[model samples]
Target: MRREFLFLSILVPGPDHPKISLDVFLQPLIYELQMLWEHGTEAYDVSCQQNFNMRAVLMWTISDFPAYGMLSGWTTHGRLSCPYCQDNTDAFQLRNGRKSCWFDCHRRFLPSDHPYRRSRTLFTKSKKVFDAPPPEIDGYTLLEQLRDFGANRTPDCGGNGHEHVYGAGEVHNRHKKSIFWDLPY
Candidate 1:
């Protein structure tokens, strides 16, 4: 199952759509699965140390799944409390002002100096930047960039006529909306 997950993870970068089948996406997909597996495993270790019961484990598991927020009951996504506050919040207000933005760790706090403060992606070339409408580089907006890169349904490198290669956001969109920064879903 994990192998399949890893396989698929490569096909779609979390903030994007899935382009290739198990072929082209195998590398990145494996990277994503291993990453997710490592993170979840690490969180499980943390919860164990914290002595959270099964309920806690279940909550943590649900929190790790980015799609979890799209469910009817869970709307909030801001970092509400210490450590796990954001992780624990089932409901988030997406349209709320930035002050009300939610995160997955609102339940508790990992020390200010926690080591795993961030997780990174393999694509160092194209970093994600948001806050305003997608930028227009060379007369092309970000959406246009995506379309140009073939991030849409047609796949096979999209309209750019280049071999389609989608990032995480593109692939994930096909299944469900990820509750990440600047997701339009």
Candidate 2:
């Protein structure tokens, strides 16, 4: 919904050379990059004098997939929208049956022993319990690790290793190569 504008200022003012719109000059380049991103192996050419190999291709932009799609002339919505998980998403149908809602959360990435890694229910609302506390790898708990790695402040920890840092309902759409980070390795 946000609109962005690019201004190509002219140093020398003249009516003979008319002003050129930014998109008119940039669209072809964007299209070429999109082609390279989607079909790099086929679109890449050796004579182009630019590297478009697998490593170089992977080192492109780091924006969310939807933003990438917007730049590439691709629409993103519905069930198969998530570029990382794709169809493996945890989205569910709505009451109207026409659309679905996505509820990807922190629980999916939490360790099994982490107290926040549980489905909430009415019975457990009054007094939540945990079988084990979160592991302290290399004498530092997750809270300490997060603090050491500059998270501003340590999350509030309730006895059984429950830390309320990220909300349970918060969406974590960023790509993660590894979820199990028992650090100091």
Candidates in order have lDDT scores of 0.31, 0.37
Candidate with the greatest lDDT versus the true structure: 2
Write candidate 2's Cα lDDT for 1-185 as tens digits.
12442332323345532111222234444455566655555335558766555421222334465545432222256654554444345566667966866553224445666555555663234434343332333524434434433322111221123223331123322121111121112
Clashes of each: 53, 0
Model 1, C-alpha of 152: deviation from truth (Å): 35
Candidate 1 residues 1-82, lDDT tens each? 2466332121245765332222233334334444554443322346446642221111122323333433211223333322
Segments in model 1 whose C-alpha atoms lie over 4 Å from true places: 1-66, 78-83, 86-98, 101-108, 111-185
Q: After superposition, how far is residue 173 of candidate 1 from its true place, in Å?
A: 23
